[model samples]
Target: MSMTSDIYKTIAKKSPESLFKDRGSKFIGQAHPVKEEAEIERILTELKNKHSKASHICYAWQLGKNYEHYRANDDGEPNNSAGLPIYGQLQSFEVTQILVTVIRYYGGTNLGVGGLIQAYKTAAQLALESANIKTKVITEALQIDFEYALLHTVMRIIKEEQISVTSQKMELSCSITLAIRKKDLNSIKKRFDAVFGLTVITENF
Candidate 1:
C-alpha cells in the first residue's frame, strides 16, 4: 500500500507476546499499541522492572497512522544487532501506532552479531504475528461552534457527513468536538463553512 494512502494498519490493542530461544538465551517479545511518544517510556519502565534480570531490552516503535514517526533502541547490544532488526519487522508489516520490545536473558555462549540480529528479528516478528491487527483511516479532530439557532442545520450536516462526535456542549451557544475521516474532511469543512455565522476549527487529538 502507498505510504501516503488514507488508510493504514495497526495493532488493535496491546499485550501480544512471543518468546524465542537460541543457544540457551531467552528473548521475550511484546507488542503494544501506543498513542503518544510519552507512552514509550512508561511501557519500557514497566518491562524493565518486570524483567529486572534481563541482560538487554531492545525495542522499536512507529507512531502516526502514516508511520511518520519512529525510533529504535539497541540498549547496549552490538550496534544494529538488536534494534534495527526489530524495527525491520514493523516496517515489513506496514503497521504504525505501535511499539515492540524484546527482552533478552543472556546465555553463557555469545551469539555473534549476525545471530543476535536474527534472534531479535524473529522474536519481534513472532510478537507481531500474535497480535490482532486492524485497518485505520487518517482522521482529523474538529471543533465546531455555532449559536443555538443553527443547531438543527449543524446536526443535519453532521448526520449527513457521518462524523464521529466526541463531545458536545449545547448552551446558548453550541460547541462540538468530532473526528472527520480524511476522505470526508474537505467536503465536510466546506459544508460547515457555508453555515451562516458558524465557526469550525480543526485540531489534533
Candidate 2:
C-alpha cells in the first residue's frame, strides 16, 4: 500500500521500552523529518544505501486519512511481511507526519510470519519513540494590513494574542500575514476590527 493521507506531525527522539529483541535479526530503526514527498524519497534512498546488505527494509508513513493514506512498503521481503507491521505500529501510537525506516540485518534464518511481525514491530516502535516530535494544525494566508505607524502594534498584538504572524513585508502599507488557526479565525477578525478598524480580510490566498 501507499500513504496519501494528510496528517502533520514530527518524529520523536526517544527509544521504546522492552527487551523485545527477537534475534535471528538485527534491526536499526531511524525516524526522519519529512515535510515533502521529495524529502521522503531522499531519506529512503540514503537509508537504503547505508544498509545495503540488510535482508529487507520495510517502511511506512502516515499522511492523513486511511486507505493508502497509510503507506507501507515491503521492500524485498515477503508480501505483507515488512511494511504492514510497521504501519500497524505507527497507527498504534497515533503518530502522523512521520517516516520510519527499519533496516534489517538478517540472521541466517527466516523469522517466518510471527517472528517477522515481532521484529518489525519492535523496530518501528523503537524508531518512533526516539523521534520525539511535535506538530500543530496550520492554515495558510491571512492578510492584515495597516499604516506604518501601527505595524509594531499589530505585530505586538499578534504575538501577545498567540496569533502566528507569518509574514511582515510589503510596500506602502505595513502588511502582515498570519497563519491563522482554523478555530481562531473569528477571534482574529474581531481583534482586527478592534485594533485596526479598517482592517481588510481576503481569502485570495
Task: Choose the strongest candidate by lDDT.
Answer: 1
lDDT tens per residue, model 1, 67-163: 7899999999999999999999998988899999999999989999999999999999999999887888788888899899988999998888778
Q: What clash count goes with each model?
A: 0, 20
Per-residue lDDT tens digits of candidate 2, residues 1-205?
2243233455544344222346567877766655556777887787678878877767887664222355799888878887898888877777666677788887787788888877888888877766675754545467887877887677777878787766677566677777766556677777777884447564622
- Whole-model lDDT, model 2: 0.69
The TM-score of predicted model 1 comes to: 0.85
Model 2 residue 62 lDDT score = 68
Error of 1 at 137 (Å): 3.1
Model 1 CA lDDT for position 99 = 95
Query: Considering every candidate listed, which one attains the maximal TM-score?
Result: 1
Error of 2 at 169 (Å): 5.4
Error in Å for residue 65 of model 2 = 10
